[model samples]
Target: MKEITFYLDFVSPYAWLAFERLPQALEGLSYHLRYRPVLLGALLKQHTNPGPAGIAPKRAWTYRHVSWLGHSLGVGLDMPARHPFPPLPLLRLALECSGDGFVNRFVAGTILRHVWQGGADALDPARLDALRAALADQLRQDEDAPERAKRLLRENTEAAAAGGVFGVPAFEVEGRLFWGLDSLPMLRACLDGDAWFDQHWERAASVPQGLGG
Candidate 1:
């Protein structure tokens, strides 16, 4: 009966890519998922962590690496440059789906697919509405669909911000925070009773460049 709270913003390409593996990573493991929708730009302005795009050299390097990672993961991801909007509406849709006890993996999957598979305009309302229609059709839901979707998005975003989240694809396990989708494997390991958390003083060669407030 362990739990993981995932904080995420829709605008992040890395979050989309990370979502590709996280669901499966949780399989066969005892865990519950709590999704929190937060704003990435707000967090970036907080003087805490910097976005990957801020560092031209590192950003370039990460994109190349992400290309290879996507290939390995069998996920189709458009290059990061193409998708630059926040994923608030989409994440709200996911939360709304969860309320029905039918986690719309398709919506989640489509979000990932659109973001990484040469389909970079996933944030467009038209595209999102179409996706929602398809998902609702799949789920056979017909009541006030648009309104509900909007409500879900707003509520979740506010709740996410209130939860101390400043980024997307963040995972919290019983109060321990794991930011970024790349950290999911570590989160999984921690939940499965790994002792990686017991040690201290695992210092980096330098402070993460943007971590200075």
Candidate 2:
């Protein structure tokens, strides 16, 4: 089976939405999903991404798109009135659990729901402590396992930065990067052996915009 690495930050609503949808989307594809926990600040600095909502034009349209997407996908997403802070801790845990496929999926899906739907403060230390406790019970982890989980979260974020991951909801298939949740379909297509590399890598005509006539 082919492998697809998914880089995500728990703080991103788009990442949360993508996390829940990827499994169903890739069910037919012969691929393994590898989770990478990354730092948003690093990617934003490199790409010069304006902020969480994106630049003016894109940001203006994104809310409607997100609302429409939620309705279509049947995914409940509660976007905060203000930009939610980064979900670094939760993302760290995801990265560390990448090797444990089942556990990673559980954490990814559950935690995203916890924040997006449950309205839990995903960044709170006590909330994470509760999550670890519950997870340990479900996973049959022994006493004090929550500490280990926290450690895992820390290690994964560090590894994510080292792996050239700059943003959340980024996908890497065979070492190629496809950023954003919208790219998942294409990523899955490549994993299914459709050989989409040329489509993404080939240099295309650049349409100049933002120029005053």
Candidate 3:
């Protein structure tokens, strides 16, 4: 079975959407989904790309679009009152559960669900404490868990950038990059061997006349 590396950040609504839909998309497939938590902000900085929410108009559209997508998918998504909430801590927490696929998925899903449903207070001290307690046994295994987690996140982000990733919800299948929640269909197509590229299709030559004179 081939591996699909799913790069994500909790701060992105699109990432949240991908999270909810990926399992179903890959259902009955021979791909193993490996979730890698990375700091989206760092990636954007490295790539010099602006975040969707950074533009006022795009931000407004994103909320509506993501909400509609969520509804269509039957996945509840309530935009956090504070969009772009600090995701560093959450990313670190996710990395703490790395290597254990089930635990990692649970932790990532829990954090994204909390932000999407509970809004800004998703990471309040009480909530964090509760989460920590829930994963106490796993946490106890590492003496410097927090620091180590932070380092892991940084390494993940760096690795992602090096791998040509510039945004959340990116997927890599056999070194082919698919970025965005919308790319799920394309990813699925690739997995099913039905994608256009699978047929050895080549890009048509661009006509110079088509370029601005």
Candidate 4:
């Protein structure tokens, strides 16, 4: 079975939607999924992007769109009490359980749900303490876990950016990237061995580009 690495950031509502819908989207597939948490800010910085939330109008549109998308797709998603909250705490918390930087599906899903399920404050200190306690039994954490998790997050984010990942909720398989919550169908088509990919895959980058048109 081919391995598909799912690169995600807790800061993205779309990532939560993709994570929720993936099981149904790829049911009966012979692929192994690896959940990876990365810093979305770092990913955007590597690509020189201001991010969707950096713009005023687009931020509003994105929140509205993601809420609708999740609703339409049968996955519940609600904006947290704040937008663009610092994800460092959550990201590090998730990484603490990932020795090889590949988080367990259950762990990643639970964290995603913690952020997306309710319209509460994701950065609330008390909530974070509760979440940390909840996962304590599942993890054999060390006293220096915080520092280690921070280092691991940096390494993972750097590697992801080097691998051409510029955003959250990106699926990487067969060296091809399928991004966005809406790209699940396209990903499935490729995984299903569609003939169209065999014919046109290379043309995406091989096609001639017109300069200064």
Candidate 5:
């Protein structure tokens, strides 16, 4: 059996789409999933990346591309009332759902739908209250739950960056990182036991980087 760690932030539309598309994408393959909600902003800052949403034109393009991806992939996705909203609450909520650092597919999907299905404010107080209610059964409301969730999210983010994960919707399989929603096909190929990975995948990263000093 194989395991894949799914790293995502609730603030990412691509993450939302990938979460819904994953099972179908990897159909017929048996694998375990670890849902890890990380801080995308922290990852971006570490890599000196502004992310797609940081630039005006790219943000527009990202919005259009993700919307098209949703329709083509048959997943529900709608822009929140805003882009780049704070994802801390949502991330904490998700961890609280499992009372651990990881979430199962069902819990992940439920939280994702709450964000991607409605075009309203994803972080609106009322909406979050409702979301909490929906997951009450799974949520751990102990005095330590909030701090534990925060610590776990921080640890997850640090682990992701140290492991070469620079973006969301990233899947880690047997120590290899496949990033972005667009990489689903490649991920499936890897899972299918393709020979190309053994022959050429890691070699791609070993190529010399040339920088004019």
Candidate 6:
């Protein structure tokens, strides 16, 4: 079975949606899903891509689209008051509880649910402390766990950037990067060896002067 690396950050509602639906989508498929934590802000800065919330039009459309997607997927997704919340603490927690795949999924799901579904503040220190306490038994039991987790997050972000990942809810299958939550179907097609799955896009120097050009 091939391994699919799912690079995510909790700040992204799209990532939350992907987390909710991916397991069901991948059922009966011969692919292993690996969760990786990366800083979306850093990725944006490094790639010079404007964030969804930073643009007024995109932000308005994103909320509506995400809500519609949630309904389609039968998953509850309520955008928190703080849309672009700080994801560092949650990312660190995921790293601290990283050994077991199930545990990692649980931790990531819990954090995502709290922020997206529960309407809780993702950056609230109290909320983070409560979550950490809830998973105390599962997290790393070292005094330096926080530091170790931070380091791991940095390494993961650097590795992801090096591997051509520039966004959240991205997937990598056999070294091919499929970005965005909408790319899940394409990723699945690639994994299934579908003949129609073409990863290439033709590039042109200038727009054709036919209709709107």
lDDT per residue (tens digit) for residues 1-213 in model 3:
888888988888888889999998878888877788888999998878787778999988988999998899898888777776778877777777764322356677777787787555766888778777776655536667677787788788888899999888899988888999889888888888885865443343233565675
Worst 10 residues of 4 by lDDT: 137-146
Where does candidate 4 stray beyond 4 Å?
211-213
The local distance difference test score of each candidate is 0.65, 0.65, 0.79, 0.89, 0.88, 0.81
Cα lDDT over the full model 3: 0.79
| Residues 1-213, model 2: lDDT tens digits | 777777776677778778878888777767777665565765667667666466776766776676678778998877544455666565545433443322456666766666777555666778778766655534533554446655555555566666666677888777767777788887777776675566645544244677798
Worst 10 residues of 1 by lDDT: 198-207
Clashing pairs in 4: none
TM-score, cand. 3 = 0.87
- lDDT head-to-head 5 vs 6, winner: 5
For 45-88, candidate 5 gives per-residue lDDT tens digits of: 99899999889999989999999988988887888888778899
Q: Under the 3 Å rule for N, CA and C atoms, how many clashes does model 3 have? A: 0
TM-score of each: 0.70, 0.71, 0.87, 0.95, 0.96, 0.88
After the best TM-score superposition of candidate 5, give how far the Cα of residue 194 lies from its true spot, in angstroms: 0.8
Model 2 worst lDDT run, 10 consecutive residues: 94-103
The C-alpha stretches of model 6 lying farther than 4 A from their native spots are 99-103, 197-213
For candidate 6, report its TM-score. Answer: 0.88
* RMSD (CA, angstroms), candidate 2: 4.8
Residue 34 error, candidate 2, Å? 1.5
Which stretches in model 3 have alpha-carbon errors above 4 Å?
99-103, 199-213
lDDT of 1 at 107: 56
Q: Candidate 2: lDDT of 126? A: 86
